[model samples]
Target: MIRPLLLLAAASLLLGCAQQTLRGTGDLGVVVERATGSVQIIETSHQTRLARIDGLGDLSHASVVFSRDQRYAYVFGRDGGLTKVDLLKQRIDRRVIQGGNSIGGAISQDGALIAVGNYEPGGVKVFDSKTLELVADIPATPLADGSRNSRVVGVIDAPGRRFIYSLFDTDETWLLDFSQGNTPKITRFKNVGKQPYDALLTPDGRYYVAGLFGEDGMAKIDLWHTRRGVERILDGYGRGEQKLPVYKMPHLEGWTVAGNQTFVPAVGQHRVLVMDSQTWKQTDAIDVAGQPIFVMARPDARQIWVNFAHPDNHQVQVIDSETHEIIATLEPGPAVLHMEFTARGDQLWLSVRDGNEVQVWDPYQLKLLKRLPAESPSGIFFSSRAHETGL
Candidate 1:
């Protein structure tokens, strides 16, 4: 009887250990499953999945920003739903629908505020990151024809606890300063460019560059010296060439710097324009497979990966940053929506939407390593991004 009781106790202990739940920390990430409105938390180190949190409402175009501690994720959904998810518990702490439609979001430098860019009834909304309470609302009032709805994009946080964004309808750029108090001090720059599709801040949060859809060049702002105001760079970039009809606006998120050169995607063109970061002058152009959607660099800055817009979306082109030349072009499968590198950039994970799976690859070897099943995965974000500015 004594031996049987000891055996039963040991069995119970083993069962409890097997049922222990996993938490989000250390090399953790999430895959946005747009079709099902869920995010699958993954442990990238072990190539294992942790949990899928659903009911995130209309995530057809979703983006996530992690908290400072990396234990919480703030998901911005297409239907204007903002959800604060506890990565440790695999549950939502709070959620609110603050607008009619939203494009993306950003967290302030100090992680005290969150700002969301809107498409419908265009404007930007800010909320407290901790409490999810409304802090301020700034509408993108059209400067051209007095219209109210001006789609806002390229919303990002800079130093000094400020948020900056561009207006599509009015062709304007606005900066909101929140350092002084709860009331934001707004600064508007008019006629910066036509139809600013999207923008990106330099890694140091020094410059904000906006790509134009209605024109040939992009608008650049010197955040460190706002007195110089906004200037146009890469003017007439699409001149002389008969451009292919743009199916999807080339994403400026691909605007990245490798060494001293800034690589930018030319709208409707199958080339990436390279510029000197210091001079903002066009230095060269690299021809690619198709209209480039994203031009991301490896962590070590040794290679740059270029993904296309469509008709050629299945491919990824790798460029040697040192030589300024194309090294390899890989066909990772169909409808490759996004790619993310591991924290160390040793492994690259890509989402093949048509294949309904994510594939990991060795960037240096240019070889496929492993594949994991997913549900229409679009974006792959890791917690390490929390430490970077203008992410």
Candidate 2:
């Protein structure tokens, strides 16, 4: 809790606040797929190489978005640079240099606005999805002691709602309402759990879950009533306290919601943790490759793919959610980071962060479909099958 003294101090130092939102529609449908350094476009239907856009610069591609019309794709680099590509011509359209490396982002559901996270100052930049212009930039809450600055990590359009949720490094999450001038009032939570990494939502859009890195636990909270109190899961103890250890590195990536269940990887455990969406209890786990980053799931939740950062066995392990068994080991090599599936679920987009290329895989046969290149690729997203983002 904020002590009365600290509260009074914070109240006196309040400088100002800012919020902005836009209306109408947008152009281009963009999803930034990762390659260590190359811009890749995977075909939605077959995960085929639709095209490759490259030579971004010294900074690596971290987050990407395609224009609504599919004419342009914007790629964000780690050090605040943007590369605009022509999806049709498969060339450079334009680029914008913004804040810092993008941890995550949220595109307005209508495709009008785009918000990206900057790591250094933990700034959030709002952009015009069409012209790719900077609309507004909001700096994260500063620390009194002035530690390493905070960054916005993950962001998504709240399912069935107009509010946008953003996670930051400061152990806090903010709910931004687009209905009222796009200004998101920060809701402060004291015991939100340390190192809160990312959040996932249910298909029906009733629940929102945030992953906790410090503990073997995750905060499974109600979307609408999250502030009331959070439901706990796998909350084990460590040392002299109930503080659980997920892993020394944790490296909790994105989350996959399968049917009424949600699956997430414990990077260190090399296993997928199973949980019931309703109860939010970790039910079971199954073996997979080392350092499994993110999971891919279809609407039916029949097929699930778990990708890894294994140097030797860098492949996506396909599993049958029903049997909870690994059916296929789909490898798309040269060392990659996690997987991004196209909207249709036939193909997969894998980021080759070390190779500067994005690898596409066939979800069924464990075969390599094709390869696309980008500059120091990182985030992989499919707009049609868009989720909050594991990036």
Candidate 3:
């Protein structure tokens, strides 16, 4: 029938499309789960199928982060282990098996090192990117619970060689100094906020801001002086007679920094909060759909795209960055969780979680160009700026 013919034609075109795997450029990797254990890697440029890293056993595919050099992608497999994937080889470089649940991690700028977080034990492990060797396991003690119930959630490196920051499931933040080399002088402290979910350090390392969930707010940690780490809280909501509950269940999910400003997606609040990084002051908040989970911005800093977790109709809403206006809405069918754009900001690639496929969209024309199916593609990472060079 025409349906089979149409699929055949689409397949032929995708097979013929060649993706230039340019190393070390602005590219995105969506670390997604197929079923319970498998992880698929999809190239955003030309919608080419690059590789698949598998063999995990009933493990949860939590998060995926690319090295600063864009050479190796570190995949934190919930129950499996930490997987190091070679970008060039399009294969698994090595898999280091660790006991606790694989929460997630972030890579250093040099790409020579990586930190993997274990949710159960509330510990993080630094590893060798090249040899897949385990370097040091900086065990974190949960603040309130003396119990291992606290989880290491978001992990990002500070500017320069100053500190390593990771937000715990609870309200604690761990700051590790790597300039001292192998043994990083660790300074662990509590973020002056409730339910610290994720944190981002400004490009200049002037501020370390964390998104709060238990309370409707965010915490800004002044890291200008490593010795004197200061923090300020920003209220994100107002309590009405109906009690909208301004700071109640404020789940700050995805965030991005542009110049001296910071944009955060308050998932539970269903709004985006803009703040001044230097002064740690609230600027304005743009409203979006309810349950806005995954938020991202284009490389050009022109638009901010947010993805909702609604099962009935999952979509990506494009908001003008400068104007703070809603511009476009893109639907990738059912169960769409995460999204990423090519370097040039021309094509937008999304993970259709329920469909078990990756949806490719043309941002300029606001069109759905193609859908590349990869079983349980929870994570999709690309190789450099191949797409930008093509256009």
Candidate 4:
């Protein structure tokens, strides 16, 4: 009887050990399954899907941010669902619907707060990163007529525990400093431009620039010198050219900086604009296959990969950073939604929405490495983003 009991106890111990295996999340990432309202957990090292988590609401335009520890992912859905996903446990730890329509979100410098921007109600909400509890709710500035609150866009995490964003309806930019307490000290920069559609923060977190959709330029604000106010750059960039109809708006977050030059997509144009990082002046414009949607740089900044909007969405063009010329053009498939590079830039993963799979590529050789199945994947986010200033 004692020998039989001992054997059963030994079998139970082995089962417990097999069920809990230790691993690291450095190579782990999540791919947004937009159509199914799910996310597939993937690992770069193996180039495979580990698991798929579902129940995330309305992920048509979803975005993700990682916790400081890289063990959790905060998914911001278009339906205003803020979900805290446990990457290790492969499940959602918490979820809350904080607004009517959410566009995107960002994590604080200290990783204690998560800020989300909304489109319907028009405001930014801050929540405790750990508990997902509301910390602060900042309504967007009202229009001159006091009709409605401006729609918040370009929400990004900056250094010094600050959050900076643009006002689409009010033509303004704001900086919310939370270094003090839960109540933030707000700094408003008015008359930024005609319509600041989207914005991007430099990798170093120094300059925050907003792209104007209603005008031909961008608005720049130097965080180091807030007293200098907003300076308009690339003014009259499309002065004489007959603009084409933009089927889809370009994403400023995809703006890339290679060497000393910044590459940005020109709205309603089939060109990628290159500007000097120091002077903020247009250096050259490289014509591409179509209206540029995401103009992103390789992790090492050696090449620029560009995707396009509808009618030309089937193509992707690569540009040589130093030569400012088209190096190669490849057709991955229709609806090349997003591109993400590995931490060291060795592998490039692209979400081919129409193809219903994510293609892994060797960026240096421009060779297809592997393909992982996904359900209408749109965004591919890695754990390495936790350390980046503005992802």
Candidate 5:
């Protein structure tokens, strides 16, 4: 009887081990299927798709943020859906309609809270990261006319458990500190610029810059020195030249700082603007294939890759970081909406919306390695973003 019991216990242990699959979350990520309202679980190490989870709701303008542990993904959908997906389980763990229209979201530094920026009601809502419970609702500062709350854009996580964003209608930048508790201490910077469309936080969380759509320059605030207020940089970038009609608003979040220089997309112009990071002054502009949309840096900061808007979206141009020259140009496909680099920068991924595929390439060689079929893919976010600030 003792021998039989020992054998049964051993058999049970074997079954338990067989039921669970051991893997790390570091290599895991999701590709947004914009048209289907779904995401495909993918593994970067293998460059393969693991599974697809659906019912995310209106991903036409979707973005994702990862938990500190990188086990879950918080997807912000255009139709106001905030979904918490368990990467290990390959399913949605919890979901809530947090707003009427949310463009993007960010997770706190400690991974304790999730913040969603809204457009309809024009406010930011904070939620408990674990339970998806509303922790705080801070409306956007109302305009001077007091008719409506200004639309919030460029919601991003910063150091010290804080959130930084821009007010479109009010021309202001707000810094919300949540380090104390649910009640946040707010610091507002007024007169940032006209029509502040989008903002980006430097990798070190030192500077928060907003792109001005209604003017020629950008509004920058040195987080390390907030008393100086908003300082305009790259002023008169298009002053002496006729500006072309903007096909799409250039996204500042894709701006890159390689070494002492910063590269950004010139709104309504077929050029990539290079800035001196230390002085916050325009150094040079490199002509590109089209009106640049995303001017992103490779992980190692050796090369800057750029894509365009609308009719020129089929091509991608690579620029050398040091010389500020167009190194190479490749025709990826139609409607290249987004690009993401692997954690180590060895591989680069491009989402071709019209092509209905994601292309993985060897950045150094500029050669296509593989193509994965996707349905109107827009954003390809990896779990590596879990550790980075203001992703």
Candidate 6:
């Protein structure tokens, strides 16, 4: 019995050494399997599925951000679970329940801190990226009339060691500055707009924009000049118009910039609003087939791709960034949730939730390149995204 036990130990040691030799690449990407609380890691260059890891908690609305080294992935689960996964090993390194309900998270510019926005207790929590230790707990303070805890969304890292988020109940936006110490210096801007659901920071980390759910415009904050306060842009752009019934609120994450123009989705309207980043004004509106959910620009910035809300989600439309005209519309099957481009924009991956597959397409040729199966997939994020700002 002693001899057999020694042989088993030797075999285990050899297996561990074999696993250590396996290496991961920055070109690899992950697709969320929301139904099973799992993610499938894939090699984007070859369009090959590598492995599927399960047991992640409540991934119904999961979002992922990577560390600066691109070796660790921080997955924010809707059930308030913050999981740190080692991409090289394809396993979870650490996990903790930081809140009652969570929306998403972001890693600091220096990669020392990870901040998550909560909905239940309603505030932001900052943690040590490496140790998963709590560093700060910022509660969204109540309003003058004593409203309930405001749901926090779009917590994004800024250039100056600061994080920005919006409070849904108070109708205000706050900047939590952690530059000096772990104790965040809170600065609040009042009357930004009603129900600012989600936000986006430009690639340069200069502008932070929030979409208003209760109004027709969006609130923009120039982080470069915080004293100017939150300025309203595209104010009442949809006023006095007969708008369609919106099945889902347009996602600000879908809004993107191409060349000199930033394309944004018009709420409850079947159109995409174009804004000039230089002039900070609404320049044009492109009519689409349905209510736009995601207006994303490919990595090359040569064309913009648009996806729609339910009932029209089966269609994907491509627009020429220069002419702002619809060039092609392809049927990518049902429940097309998200899209991601390769590092150089050579290949575009589309996640089809209902179809249970991810389809890769060649934009110029307007042809289907390949299709891979996924389980209720939503977001497709790559490790190369770590080097980009406001991912």
- For this target, which candidate reaches the highest lDDT against the unseen true structure? 4
lDDT of each: 0.89, 0.60, 0.64, 0.94, 0.92, 0.89
Estimate candidate 4's alpha-carbon lDDT, on a 0 to 1 scale: 0.94
For model 3, the stretches where C-alpha displacement exceeds 4 angstroms are 1-31, 57-61, 142-145, 166-170, 236-238, 241-253, 311-313, 383-391
lDDT of 1 by residue, 1-391 (tens): 9999999999998988867754447588889999999998887888878889999999887888888888888999999999998888888899999988999889998889999999977999999999999999998875457756799998888899999999998889999999997799999998898899899889888999999999999999999888889999999998999989887776676577877988888899999899998999999999999999888889888998989988999999998887879999999889898888887888898899888998889998999989999999988888887887776
* C-alpha lDDT (0 to 100) for residue 257 of candidate 1: 88
lDDT score, residue 193, model 2? Answer: 64
lDDT of 4 by residue, 1-391 (tens): 9999999999999988977777898999999999999999999998989999999999998999999999999999999999999999999999999988898999999999999999868899999999999999999988779887899988999999999999999999999999999999999999999889888899999999999999999999999999999999999999899999989889999999877999999999999999999999999999999999999999889899999999998888999999988988999987999999999999999999999999999989999999998999999999999999876
Q: Write the per-residue lDDT of candidate 5 for residues 163-193, one digit (tens) a residue.
A: 9999899898899999899899999999899
- The order by descending TM-score is 5, 4, 1, 6, 3, 2
Q: How does model 2 fare in lDDT?
A: 0.60
Candidate 6 or 4, higher TM-score: 4
* TM-scores, each model vs. reference: 0.94, 0.75, 0.81, 0.96, 0.96, 0.93
Candidate 3 Cα lDDT to native: 0.64
Rank by lDDT (best first): 4, 5, 6, 1, 3, 2
Residue 251 CA displacement from its true place in model 2, Å: 7.2
lDDT of 4 at 245: 97
CA displacement after TM-score superposition, residue 145 of candidate 1 (Å): 4.7
Model 2: residues >4 Å from true position, as ranges?
1-38, 42-52, 58-61, 89-91, 159-169, 226-229, 237-253, 311-313, 351-360, 367-380, 386-391
| Candidate 1 residue pairs in clash (backbone atoms < 3 Å) | none
